[model samples]
Target: MNEEELGTDLKKRIKEVLSGSLHIRHVDTGSCNGCDFEMSTLSNPIYDISRFGVSFVPSPRQADMLMVTGGVTSNLEKALRITYEATPKPKMVLAIGACACGGGVFGETYANAGGIDPFVPVYVYVPGCPPRPQALIQGILLALDQYEEVLKRGE
Candidate 1:
């Protein structure tokens, strides 16, 4: 499919996964805050993701999706696990940025504990040192595709 078609398909899948409920909780393990900055901008006037029926939640327990950024750090492992554990069933994790997906610049650093996938299964990975907001959105939409099928099977 063409890029536009693919994007449209992704959006459709996202809508299906959401099914009128798409609350996300963001976690920062040890990011440089660049990803966080773009994520925050997603809610602003320019590209309000709320228009697509998505919202950012403060508590993990109340979220249907976990949007994690940054490389997994030794100090934040416990917190990350707790956050994931707190999230209710049928939740998907989206690792945004190269750091979160592959440890990026900190891959072999003393403080690095690897990527998010090692600790918790990542449904999607947006690969960029600091992924653009559009890239993050696309990753979320891709995860939604698999998430919808999983939910349908009641897994």
Candidate 2:
């Protein structure tokens, strides 16, 4: 779907699954910031994800979803785990970009731990060197579907 359609769908999904708001905590494990930059665009006028009831929170404790970018670096592994633990239950974790999805060019190294699956349960993976804002919205929509299913199962 187009970005506009995706945004409309995302708004509906957030209203249904999250009481009309979806607070996200964005974490940058150890990326070069490419993915993070793309994610930031969602807040700009062109994308304006906030208009769809999505907003980025400063703390995981206040977030309904975690939008993680970059490879799981050794230095940030503990921090990532802590953030995931801090987020309330029924939370959705989205792995953004190729690095967070896998290892990207950085790969598994002595300082990087590859993908984040080993640290936290990821509900969606938006793969790209730096996925566009449209892809991020789509990922959130996909996560909302899974989150709704989990809620129905009472998990």
Candidate 3:
């Protein structure tokens, strides 16, 4: 095979590595805990996120994806940045609510850093004061699609 063909084959392999499942690491910057509650329900028997190959891990190092909620408050900025850094490469960050996506009601206040995107790259932005569990699931799946595309590009 030619070099060009080999490059295409390599990209295909990278994408295939991400097609299976995503284990998440959830972070709450400075929201009202509304989105956190919704995330907790995802693991319950009703939502059963595990069945979908989505589960929350305790440490960022062990997580496959990062799910962040609430605006990036100044106090939590370092922690958020560090957590994102610790998560492995090719990891996707999902902004779980309006605050995390674009600061919501807080909106770049003295204490808020606007959105998580400013601190770390965000792949999917799930909008809502506190989005429904279903929305979060959809956001994860959507990010998964983008995630594969990103890997294909060798980025």
lDDT of each: 0.83, 0.90, 0.80
In candidate 1, which residue ranges exceed 4 Å CA deviation?
1-14
State which candidate, 1 or 2, has the greater lDDT: 2
Total backbone clashes of model 3? 0
In model 2, the runs with Cα more than 4 Å from the true position are 1-4
Least accurate stretch of 10 residues (summed lDDT) in model 2? 1-10
- Measured by TM-score, the strongest candidate is 2
Candidate 3 clash pair list: none
Best first by TM-score, ranked: 2, 1, 3
In model 2, the clashing pairs are: none
For model 1, residues 7-71, the per-residue Cα lDDT tens digits are 45545666666656589999999899989999998889987777777789989999999999998
Candidate 2 C-alpha lDDT tens digits along 1-155: 45658878888878888888999999999999999889899998988888999899999999999999989989999999999999999899999999998899999889988898989999999998888888888999899899999999998
- Global local distance difference test of model 3: 0.80
Error of 2 at 96 (Å): 0.3
